[model samples]
Target: MKLSKNFTNPLAANNPVIVQILGICSALAVTVKMEPALVMGLSVTFVCAFSNLIMSLLRNGVPSRIRIIVQLVVIATLVIVVDQFLRAYMYDVSKQLSVYVGLIITNCIVMGRVEAFALGNKPWDAFVDGVANGLGYAFILVLVAFFRELFGSGELFGIEILGDWYTPNALMLFPPMALIIIGCIIWVHRTINKDLQEK
Candidate 1:
């Protein structure tokens, strides 16, 4: 794939969340609010990009029998680093993210790109792909978080947006609402891209 495509495609045409439907767990878990969602998104982006880069660099040297193990190690190391950084600086958000930060190690989006793209592509290309996909994931997360926080809590990033007269929808803060929001996003995306609906 061209470098531009590697960087741009995932933002829309190949979005990990809306298109590929990967990483939905974190999307639902952390998006009850915006701050944790933003933190989680950036942390995942960092992990995905660096892990892909490292995996690409080691692709040729990794023994076929142990490549998956090697990829997990790299991903785990990166996730630990991100977790530690969040703990140190964004302690509250870190606590809010809790296990989900560690769970990034198990995210299919990270593993899939590392195995399917980084293993066969150049390091830079892999890095771009990872970052692009991460951003795609982040974009949907933020979008969902925006609505959830806005309607669920009458706020955005903890700043109150709705007036005292406004009544928040309690259900919007729940996991089922996340699935509904994501479903709506997928519906709109497919509606706009008619080719995506063709079977």
Candidate 2:
């Protein structure tokens, strides 16, 4: 039951992107297109899952004072692996992602799970939590990208979806529009999960 909660809650109740509002930077930056958003999401998921497992495995040996530093090192190493893999096989998407791929080290979702859950949980449980959080974050990114790409360019993954008769809305491509979309998501999320609403 606990493991299921760890796997399920982040999808909505504790979503790192919309509920906890972590990793918003990448959510805004890489979500302009579906392909990049999907890549970015997978990158984050890999880093978060492994980082959590590693940290959980090392939790007992690491000195408390240096834990944060160690966590950064672990996360950075994983991010580097993901970045290089993308550069090697998906050069175009890598270029589209730019520094944001490296920036996964600093994504709140990665470090946040390490500090909050991995430090104390068993390795399997921590891994599941990390995967859940990563997926939750990805869900929002893809959803936002779906709207942005469709409306902004009348395409998905750069392939034309809407007929040319539909004029693309330029504003949908802008960062501010991503913010508004996120705001609407949060509003709707809070409305549905009354527990998240203010008392």
- Scored by lDDT, model 2 comes in at 0.94
For model 2, the stretches where C-alpha displacement exceeds 4 angstroms are none
Q: At residue 96, give the lDDT of candidate 1.
A: 100
List, residue by residue over 1-199, the lDDT tens digit for candidate 2: 9889889999989888888888999899998999999999988989999999999999999999999999999999999999989999999999999999999988988999999999999999999998988889889999999999999999999999999699999999999999999999999999999999988
Poorly placed runs, candidate 1 (over 4 Å): none
Tens-digit lDDT track for model 1 on 1-199? Answer: 5899889999998899998889999999999999999988888899999999999999999999999999999999999999999999999999999999999999999999999999999999999999998889999999999999999999998899999999999999999999999999999999998888968
Tell me the lDDT of candidate 1. Answer: 0.94
lDDT, candidates in the order shown? 0.94, 0.94
- Return the clash pairs for model 2, or none: none
